[model samples]
Target: MNREPLSTKEKLLDVAEELFASRGVEATLVGDIVQGAGQRNPSALRYHFGSRDGVLQAILEKHLTRIEERRAKLLASWPAPGPRTPRDAIELAVVPLAELLSTEAGRRYLRILGQTMYELAPDQMKGVGKYPSLSATIDLMRGCIDTLPPRVVDERIQGTLLLISAMLAIRARDMSSRRRPPLPLSTFQRNLIAMATSTLTAPHDEP
Candidate 1:
């Protein structure tokens, strides 16, 4: 027998996640999610999530929680940080990211995260901060970030984030016909880890 359709609320969130992931938050409107969800109620967004930003906060906070949990586990398993090789710090950030991006759902969410960071609104970022696990990772990164000189670390972090974002968004199949949709998760993860290690460990030009 055919199963009952998802509750209106569940359907809204399901559609919202895909729309937000594929289109970026600002570009994906409430109308679109509601329509895609097949819920004819005109006030569905307001009734369920309260407002546009509220919906964004709910979805992003949920997304970030899962990611940060994995990140914490990865950090916990790694060897403790030494005095000052910034590469150590970079690996701290990279490994878990590679692991997270290795899943099919993770691939989509990873790209959405990049788009979120790129198009970040201060309010939205603050909302993201309210999620416990994610807030902890950001706090930890900031604490360790002080070990390297400010200018150098700043440049490296920015560059690394961009490279990571690109890896998350651009599917492997875009370059090869033999590749399949959503990309193969493990291959993507290994390649990302390799690229991140090489970039982070490279010497600083001026120090």
Candidate 2:
């Protein structure tokens, strides 16, 4: 079977994702994306995406929409009283993102996502209304650890995101480079979830 060639905009997006992941989003220039996409017209990226931020948002939406669908299905499949434990919530949070590790583009997306999340302030990270599955998962994970002080719980939730993103980004880089991952894929995932669960559920000392 034959597949359609990517449209000009898609070519720009594909190059942008790779460049953004490898070069860091702040460092990847619009002209670089345009040229990398094999476009002769320097204005192509601006024409298609309006600006660098537009392309960045488009890249995020492209991957996140798929992740949202996967997470929604996982949320639906949980037995009654969904996500009763930290591990359950962690799995919901991590697995959909982790599944993206299987391909080069997906791996690049993970790295880019990690960089993006790291750069955002905590307050800026709360606008997940567009990603209901992710929003629900965060709410449930916080509920599971509600015994903690409110501030601590918020920190833990933010920490969980940071940890998952960083670890997945490293794993993606390792896998992409054809280097031996510190652990096999299954072990890496299980340990990553367990570590994230601990980040959320570990007993906190009152200060």
Candidate 3:
């Protein structure tokens, strides 16, 4: 069977995604990525992606573009003054990624995304600003949370995003491993929607 070869840029992205997911991004080196991609040139990473951060951002953009498209379509169908249910808003944000998890690459990418969400340094965080789609979805979630009082929305929004990232990462890892007491993807999505809904809508006391 003949398989078309990956381009130099894609080879790097593929190798980097796996390494970044299995080993933390900071722990993985440009040398490691190029070597894993079957390239001998240390300069290949720099030539293709400029630097480690550039590679990571490119990988993120690749996936976010697709995920954001899904979110946009979902948002379009959802009525304006949107997301009457907590589940509605949360699903708009995450269900696309869950659908992506049906593929091997999606699982790998999710692991890297989880690491980025939880582990990146403050300076590294700036790269996230490059993705408008991601920002739009986040703003949508904030608007969804507006059903709550302004005080609660202010207090809980950041934590809600963090929790969503962490939980989805955990689920992505679990999905990749094919663990015993197996969690079906549908079940995982259902539970996540429930948890996210509760977290966003949960009552808060003013300080």
lDDT of 2 by residue, 125-157 (tens): 568888999898888888998888888888888
TM-score of model 1 vs. true structure:
0.67
Is 1 or 2 the stronger prediction by lDDT? 2
lDDT by residue (1-207, candidate 1, tens digit) is 999979988788878777776676789888998899997887898899998777777776665677678766766676777453444455555555555544655555665666655554333423545545545443444445555666655554555556766676665213222355454666665666567656544566653
Clashes within 3 Å, all models in order: 0, 0, 0
lDDT of 1 at 105: 56
Global lDDT scores for all candidate models: 0.62, 0.91, 0.76
Best by the lDDT measure: 2
- Estimate, for each residue in 1-207, the C-alpha lDDT of model 3 and write its tens digit: 998989999999999998888787899999999999999889999999999999998988888888878877876676666336556667776788778778878888887877776554433333445555566665566677676775556556555656777777777777677765256667877887788778877876556
Clashing residue pairs in candidate 2 are: none
Better of 2 and 3 by lDDT: 2
Question: Which parts of model 2 have CA positions greater than 4 angstroms off?
Answer: none
Full-model lDDT, candidate 2 = 0.91
Q: Supply candidate 2's per-residue lDDT for 53.
A: 96
What is the lDDT for 49 in model 2?
94
- Model 3 scores a TM of 0.83
Q: Name the candidate, 2 or 3, with the larger TM-score value.
A: 2
